[model samples]
Target: MRVKKDTSISLFYDMVELMERLRGKDGCPWDKEQNHVTLKPYLVEETYEVIDAIDSGIPDKLKEELADLFLQIIFHCQIAREKKEFDINDVMKLCLDKMMRRHPHVFGDSTASTSEEVVQQWEAIKKQEKGYEERKSAVDGLPKHLPALQKAQKVQKKAAKVGFDWKDINDVIAKVEEEMEEVKEAIAKKETKDMEEEIGDLLFSVVNLSRFLQFDTENILHKTIYKFVDRFKKIEKELASCGKDIEQCSIEELDALWNKVKMNARKNI
Candidate 1:
């Protein structure tokens, strides 16, 4: 199913008008009092809800959550317009201009027969646009706020594009084993900082291996975490039925219960 598309630019303006009305005299007390700083958390929350809807594969919920996200955007734009800074129109124009500049194969004589060539051309054009001096690092374009695994994957992909990567998956696997050995040594020595560093290196190498194998490290980790949560909750409910708390349970008992739940889950799957 398709969402009711915001087909006209006027829709954005209308949303802005609504935000202004809500913030006007005798309007919503909560909306009237919110500023960009105050609304930041809601923006982040709405974004995650949109991501959740997409992950759950619910088109109707996705559309609703997306509209909430757009509302946040419009709210922010309305606030900025009041300060004479920028508005939704400026945001739209900037995006349009950036896309036009980035797609040389579409708007210019440049042609790329493959996605890899397109990426290389895009990076080259980006560097030319920024004049190189502004970006001192090859991975500088990556967002710092990205989840750690995704950020690591992005950094590795960027470096690989510039030929600064392992020759094969075997090399990455070897590096991971080396990092694991360091982690084990650090653990044996009870060196907390060293152990942490080595563990991070191991995880980063795993992300690199996932990239080489054409797997999404983020999705893999997310699914694993979800499974752990589900199985743990089942164990919790089972223990509750037995009138035994987790803290009071022996390690062996907990282990047995966990394995039972896991095996049952796998059988169902």
Candidate 2:
């Protein structure tokens, strides 16, 4: 049977029913066996894949990945329904309510003419939400599994909101320099524990500097990684052209090839 690709709302409920059947008593054993805990990894993986699809600038791939992510949400809702907890309807309703409540400028009589004002009002509304009112710190609600670099930025941003931040970008730069010196001191003293600790502090300091400068540490690092891989591939191709294996090249030969590749890359840019 062929499914229509039009904007029919019934198709959404049909997909929900499809998931229900997959977990039904007479359905596939693998689908029946999954629970919230067991599906955590795939949920995280699919979310990342959706992000990757978005970054790739492909609409079709984004659509497909979004469906995969939506499936994870549906799977969780199904598990909750089976346990006599809330289901997808409740989830949607809560999200709808929250959206209406948070955007008072749109849904209520509150006024916010600027994007910055809207953000401030949204945060204020969020703090007043039922469970959030008890948050002792602005950084209290960070997801435990967020990527380290992203999590660091969130923590720094939350703290900065409460005025616990550097007064200037130069101050952040100086802190990064101080952390680097500490790392060097740890290495020179051959203190294994201090080295580990100081290295982490140095990374945190760099993350702070990036956040202060309005740069995303993860995205910047990923771009640098992609660049390094591209340069290395070029070097490999150059060596292969001469019928030579990379392992056969000395450090000097590899460096020369790398420089040549770098020059070519610069010229292309």
Stretches of candidate 1 above 4 Å error? 1-7, 130-133
In model 1, the Cα lDDT at residue 257 comes to 95
RMSD of 2: 2.9
lDDT of each: 0.88, 0.92
* TM agreement with the true structure for every prediction: 0.88, 0.94
lDDT digits (tens) for residues 1-269 of candidate 1: 56456655567667778888987887799987788999988988998899889999999999999999999988898888888999888999988988988888999888988998988888787787745667888777777668788899999988988799888788889988999999999999999999999999889888988999989999898899999999999999999998889999999999999999989998998
Every candidate's CA RMSD: 2.5, 2.9
| Residue 179 error, candidate 1, Å | 0.8
Report the lDDT tens digits of candidate 2 across residue range 1-269: 67666745687788889999999988889999999999999999998899899899999999999999999998999889999999999999999999999888899999999998998898888877799967787789988999999999999999998899999888999999999999999999999999999999999999999999899999999889999999999889888999999999999999998888889889988
The positional error of residue 115 in candidate 1, measured at the CA in angstroms, is 2.2
lDDT of 1 at 207: 91
